[model samples]
Target: MNPSQPSAPVRILVIDDTPSIHDDFRKILISRGNDASLDAAEAALFADTRSAPVADSFVLDSALQGQEGLALLERAHQAGEPYSLAFVDMRMPPGWDGIETIRRLWQVDPALQVVICTAYTDYSWSETIRQLGSSDNLIILKKPFDNIEVLQLAHALTRKWQLARKLAARMWDLASEVERRTDELRTAEARFTSAFAASPIASTIQYNYNHCFLSVNPAFLELTGQSMGDVIGHMPGELELWPEGKAWLDGVSRGDRLRKHPAKLRTRDGRLRDVLVSTEPIAIDNDACSLWLIDDITDRLELEQQLVQSQKMESVGHLAAGIAHDFNNLLTAINIYTEEALHECQPGTRLHDDLQEVQAAGRRAAALTRQLLIFSRKQFSELAPLQLAEVLDRILPMLRRLIGEDIELVSEWDSGLPMILGDENNLEHVVLNLVVNARDAMPNGGEIRLALRQTVVLASQTARHPEARPGQFLVLAVADNGCGIPLEIQQQVFEPLFTTKGSGKGTGLGLSTVRTIVSQHKGWVELTSSPGAGALFEIFLPAAPVGTVLEATGTAGAGQPASDRHRGTERILIAEDDDVVRNMLAVLFPRYGYQAVLAQDGPDALAAWEKGGGAFDLLLTDMVMPKGMSGIDLARELQSRQPDLKVILSTGYSAELLQQGTTPPIPGASVLLKPYRPDSLLAAIRNTLDAAAAAS
Candidate 1:
């Protein structure tokens, strides 16, 4: 077995009186070891399964009698690697029968799957059921069964057991986390109760009637600028802490108990501070005393304001996603129809000009929809090892055009900077967003410098930021000598749709997209600025090991011409939900010399395939639909029936649907992101089909 294989085998126990039976199971269940040939054969046979090549390896343990089997199971349970299945013989002699053995095993581990093997009808089905009761985990196997049947049963039951254990573990983890969080909250409340602002909050103990300080915590001393000796045994009026005299101090009993009183306290340095004082009376050493809880509301108010802004941004993100989903469907229809019409018109015609304008408008709207998805953080980006220097080289021309010639753009990077794991295009978007934001800040024009260097971040350095960690990073900085960001609003600069630019000029999503992209790349952004000085935005991306090469990612750029797209007369099946979009694809596929068959959903597509006698050159299906079957399942079924068929899945939003989150790519199918141009979609189909042909 490969040591790096992620999952361990499902263990099985065989309890029988005959030693020969154990030898038979070993021959059927255990392999010498899996190798390249076995893997290729397994993939060929079971490629339709989501987790293919998962032929369960078994660890078989045998016992001569039922009593000894129970002992083994108990020991396995103690070892934390209990058996997933047990094969019990009905005719075990000189001990408890199969039924009793199963009963005892269930008492220890109720989740064990059991299969009863017997040659004679010694215990009828009704008798077995009456003794053991019916269970989903119990099944009966007649003696002399085929080797294939037993092996198949082993594989299926073991996978079922593994899935159940994982689910139970996940539920346990969630319960544990909830209890842990509740404990933390209770601890915080206890700290608030017992300490009375002694730790970080300002606290002062004063005597009654005269209101002279008896003791002051360090926090209080710092706030009031008074030493322990200076504040002790001296009245607040004498020290000028609260120079309004003791009239408010005497009002504790004059109004109500446990009331909050507002006051202005003057520090020794003559600076007045706003405070909320919670006054309560207590007896200390048989004398009346007051414990005043003074809270500085300056920073607290700012925290509350930030909480409100965060809540507002969350609501806006939800709204943006809902709108983008609906808008993209409309854009899909508009774009296809305009492209189809453009082909029928002559050059230099007014109709052609009008259609061209419509297409341009549609293109701009599509770009805005992409921006909205990026802001909402729903845009699918596949992260990989990439060099930032190469990304800069690819986008420098566009960057130069973005910032006018009035602004001087400078690029600097280290000579041997390590690679970072990120989505290359998304990283480019971050650079563009930040530099454009810097350009907007300097209306009169200024220099914008983009720099990349390697740095190490210590734990102490990340103590202040929640999204940062201690590690090596590729630091990308975008700095501008522009009108600096005010300290008051610097924290809100990355908020979605919260722009300082005037209407009709900026959409306020630039910095918002930048923050989302950087964070998604497992990095953090730190901003430093002073009023009218300048601003520098630093993005720190976790660095991968040296020699990590940049990987090629898929793109939706204009592809080869229709002739070069491997145009063919092969028939293709398309399953989509939207009527307009489906009909448009049906019309467009024939233009590339491919025949088309259409269905409204997965089931409809399957029915069409069956009606065509399960034969087609290729299958094109949408990832989502209103029917019971998804495109992934539909493809799996069709591929199982016709092993050589080429398949392509398209989706409007998610790229993870077909593979379902980081599971390896589907063995024989390719994915096309939705709202793809006509030429691009054809190219994807042709390339996939040609590859299938070559493999065959």
Candidate 2:
């Protein structure tokens, strides 16, 4: 045995009647000084040339009687350091014979190695085997046996015992590991079950072979509007969930792992829902299955579409506003020149009538440009606190005629509704646009319901719509029972130039303009519709504050006609960027009994003012100008020098638009919109100059 090997010394129990036998056994197995004697005896017995074996390393405990030996073996086994082998004298006469002692010892430790030593024929080998019942642990060793044989038996038996103990220890560790792993698996399964039940995203498990639902979470049940009783053991197709049942089943059967796949499913209530589906293969109780996670994105997609539509409209609005502003400048020149030609030509002449037609066309073109500006939210509105009912009542007759006899028009409103601060004409346009859209939606004729109601909005109601605010509002709803708007296209209906009608049938600006007009009034629009179920468009306008008294819609010249009162002889300075409009104004103003001086832009006007010693009575300048000076800047600089300077501001852009980029028009300054007639410009100039004179 190697000394470096980590093992306890092998122990042996000896049973004998002679004291010498016990001492002999110790000398052969435990005593290292007896190695020389053992070697000489081995050499003489065989006359071999081989060297003696390594000194025996063992512990020996002796008992005089068989019973004593058995007691020693039992004590050693109880102490957890049992003997590996025992030498029992077969002729020992004491409390019990060697055979009886060996039987009891084997019972105590079945793995113990035993050797029966006997010189006399107390029993034959066959009789000894019959007594011990023949075991691998039992060996018959004749008395006076060779010392080498005793040493060999002790070493082999002890090493075998050590290996057995190590094997048993390893088996025990393996058993413990298997138990721990099983416990962990159980814990993981429990956690998975709990999480699956608690998750908010709809989850489902279905058998891989049958494609029938094995389990469904509460969220799945709620999302599909189905109960456990309805969904259990049922295929998705059998439940009528998928819009394309065949396609769904085919994909599932193909083992396709869906990740964020867009799908449409019909609910139990027959409403369609947009969902994102994800699935992966799983196994439950040795059965192959698929785990599905579904997310309902109907509302989210609607909001995203609304956001994109809003951004698109805003961009188009900007472009439309710019185009309208530039176009209005051209219209101004056209209309003014046409008016001048009409004054020059004789009435009832062909030339005069042609000029009148040209003038009429110019007015219509101007109206179209104004509509563009309205859609862009750049049109100035003359907002007033008025009863919406009165405005609607005035326009319903015209609407009834517009929608035709096939369509029945019905109007209803709650009494004592609060007033709104909105432009009457613009509000009328909103109502007309919605009603027109409704009428068009029902080409075969249908009922149109126009309703007005006051509503109080809450902060919580604004979660879905970012444009909504918390306040009281007057809701104007136009509903039609006609071929309804589809859910997929509802978000696009409000975008400019997005029309469902054929060519030349619609401008596509109806709903867009309605939204723009409502937004300009500090309001929002809500639309609800289902396919083949009609559409409802609701316009929410902020209500005027309580106790707000309506003011009379009148001006200083209400008592007299505008043309008669608008003449003035005061010198007026005009600044314009367009040559045609500028020249037209220069010629037109002097004809109205006013002294007119012209400049190309604000800087040129400033130099002219300085050259003439600021003698002009009123400064009429365009809002947007050249040479780094706006109309507002020029007025501010001149007013700084002349505190009582009278000024009139003109622009093709709305006042709201000008305020966003530069300084707003000064207080007390009159704003004259472009494409103006000879009367409107003259009225503005005369009013501005006369107001200053009256103040002085």
Best by lDDT: 2
Best by TM-score: 2
lDDT values, one for every candidate: 0.80, 0.83
The TM-scores, one per candidate, come to 0.62, 0.79
Model 1 lDDT per residue over 1-696, tens place: 111111486789999999999998887778525455544544555666457324446889999899999999999888777898899998888998999999999999888889999888988889989999888888889999766567767777777777777776777777888889999978976885567545676887777766778777788988888888898899877888766626776675343244456777888999777778887787667877887778877667668878887788778877997787677777787887898788889979999999999999998788777777778866755778877888887788899899999999999986777888888777887888888889998999989999999989998988757798898999999999998989878877888877878888888888888888788788888999987888999998999876788666565334755555557888999988888888888788787788899999988988999999887989898766776777777888888888788888876665643345543445757887656667667788878887777877
Instruction: Score candidate 2 by lDDT.
Output: 0.83
Task: Please count the clashing residue pairs in each candidate, in the order shown.
Answer: 0, 0
Give the poorly placed runs of model 1, Cα more than 4 Å off: 1-203, 217-250, 253-256, 259-277, 283-288, 293-314, 338-360, 552-560, 627-629, 633-646, 656-668
